[model samples]
Target: MGKVSTFSPAQQAENTSSKIVVALERLSEAFRVLLWQEATQYGLSPIQIQVLTFLLHYPEEKRTVTSLALYFNMTKATISDAVKSLEQKNYLVRKPSETDTRSHSLHLLKEGRAIAKKVEHFAAPLQDAVATSPLKEQGVLLDQLMQLIYQLNQEEVITHQPMCFNCQHYTEKKGNYCTLLKISLKQANLRVDCPSFETRED
Candidate 1:
């Protein structure tokens, strides 16, 4: 008789989760490309659109590069590059941070604000369409997604610790990187065995 092939319950769960991630990633990328193309009609890149959108809802109307980097989980250099480009295009302005001289606060200029407002206005119908859904359903979906994200993060911590520890870009700063990321490093170490972990260039 041929040997029976069977996967443990854990193995089946892992396989299902992996497939879901791939599907979600592809869907996200497709939407992102579509959104970027839409932004081009207003002469804005996806990043610029995000920045402007953030600014519209930001209580302070501005943020430091460090703050933005942390919010976006990005590197300082990348944020600086984006800020410089926006400044040159008159879409953003940089001012000295009162709290930290070394760090500068970024503010959208009048032109930038105007453009952002336009984008927001243009997106109203789409936003309204999404908002029309029942709040309970939206909340349920949000909770489910949050739980899945937490599970994935826990798995990553278990599977990717050693790889993260050896990465040159890993910093030990508090509330910033490394240390915070290390809180779940054990699971991450178990998640992936890849040795190379470089910060995103963007």
Candidate 2:
């Protein structure tokens, strides 16, 4: 067998950011491969599985095709196809929107919910590895990732999604709060993908 090469940070002294790029690419590819394997067991595409998982976690109002397209950074047509596939498989159901009878909202069926639960844990290996790290280190890693995502959104490199910290509705005074919802926010309650997120003007 051919020898596998590893990334060498020492050789990338001239451009340290190259190492981060390589690491991120490798992590993304690894996760995609693992997700694909898990998706195939249910005879579903990765995007379809992702939709089901999103519906499982998000409220019904946020499960519209338009919202999903924006969240996944895919075109509406592509998201429509995936939704149709899931519907045909009886993994998802559509109900007419209460506010707009012409539009529909997606909901996962029992089978879809089961698959979502399974796929959700498909990254247990990665999670287990992270679990071995010190808590402070883990927090640092999460914060750094969140910052990177925030930067990407700011740059418009990816479609904007609901993140409490980046939303106009978010307020920080004596404590974190949501001005629109008039609710206090806990650190753990900070949503990474809020349905009601409105971008704050710079």
Error of 2 at 194 (Å): 4.3
Candidate 2 residues lying further than 4 Å off, grouped into runs, are 1-13, 169-191, 194-198
Model 2's TM-score against the true structure: 0.80
lDDT of 1 at 195: 32
**RMSD for each model, in Å, please?**
11.9, 5.4
Q: TM-score: which candidate is best?
A: 2
- Report the lDDT tens digits of candidate 1 across residue range 91-129: 888888777777667788998888878776545544565
Q: Which stretches of candidate 1 lie over 4 Å from their true place?
A: 1-15, 120-133, 151-202
lDDT of 1: 0.59
Superposition error at 95 for model 2 (Å) = 1.1
